[model samples]
Target: MDTWRQIIADDEKSWVLFEHGTCVVLTTPGDDLAAQAVSVLRDSGPVHPGTPAADFGTVPLETTPGWVITSHHPDVLTYVSPEEIAQDGDNTPLAAGLYGRSKRDQDAHSLTVIHVEDNRR
Candidate 1:
């Protein structure tokens, strides 16, 4: 299994599952589902009839293109523009788009400029 595509614990005590380039947030409070998902993911062999725990929550069999699991709380990635910047005290457009680390990161203070494509239709 690809490391990036594997289900991992979100920095904010939730489960983060990735399929394709989209991320899925399984809102299993108290990390219950996240733990189970991680166990299943780390186990050897394919996911089958009896692989997942009987009480385990639903596992998506396929990913919907251009779909996002919405949440008010930011995960590992967040988007921002020049208008949201807080340095110059002036509201000028400083960049086309500034990609910055999510505040949740351990050392969260970096920005990179890159072309962003809107996959949503």
Candidate 2:
């Protein structure tokens, strides 16, 4: 979350409206051009993830009704049904876009989706 990393000299609380939607940032977007930037950020990272897990290997375990980890490769995919979707209502997270900041690279992959909410803070 570069929004949290940047050191701004001056700022005021103004909404950084995400008209585009939400993004599910994956572990990586896969681009050789981003290798250098990734390495740099990886080396410089003291960035607090805020997530409960301390590291990737120790990702907090949560049991959802639809989940399984393979012994050979440990892959995961969840299945959601129409009933679940209806229950989720407007709170469900779904992809909305795929964008690359630099033409040469995509830093990471993310699932983006547009949502409606009152940001009147």
Candidate 3:
């Protein structure tokens, strides 16, 4: 039997599960990565099947092409722009599209950018 890596905890309200090889980020619902689908805990604090919190932003790591994950809260944000991810690198794009206007693109096939409607979108 193959072992699966699962993230669960109370302080850890949100989580991003990366595929073993693809580095794809999978989320629960509104998470779109997995179609808002996850094993939800019934009542316990941190049950075997944890409940999925509402996901917001999507951030694509500039370091790798296929490495994409959900952007956590501002304090918990994970993905960083190429400029921030690295500095003084030849591969850095002259026109790094990280800002909203630039619209940094990511590995579309391997990743999922989900934005649930909140009276916005």
- The candidate maximizing lDDT is 1
Candidate 3 lDDT, tens digit per residue, 19-81?
A: 221122222224332332122211111112222222324433433531222322222222324
Better of 1 and 3 by TM-score: 3
Question: Which ranges in model 3 have alpha carbons more than 4 Å from their true place?
Answer: 1-12, 17-33, 37-77, 81-84, 87-104, 112-121
Question: Candidate 2 or 3, higher TM-score?
Answer: 3
TM-score of each: 0.19, 0.17, 0.23
Model 1 agreement with the true structure over 3-120: per-residue lDDT tens digits: 2233332344333342222222334443344344333333311223333211111122133211122122223222233334445454322221111212112111121212222112
User: What number of clashing residue pairs does each candidate have, in the order they appear?
Assistant: 0, 2, 2
Looking at model 1, the pairs that clash are none
lDDT of 2 by residue, 1-121 (tens): 2321121112331112122211122233334323432343233222234431112221211333211111111211122223333553532223100011110012122221122121123
Kindly report which residue stretches of model 1 are placed more than 4 angstroms away from their true locations once superposed: 1-24, 27-75, 86-99, 102-121
Q: Rank the candidates by TM-score, best first.
A: 3, 1, 2
Best by TM-score: 3
- Candidate 2's TM-score reads 0.17
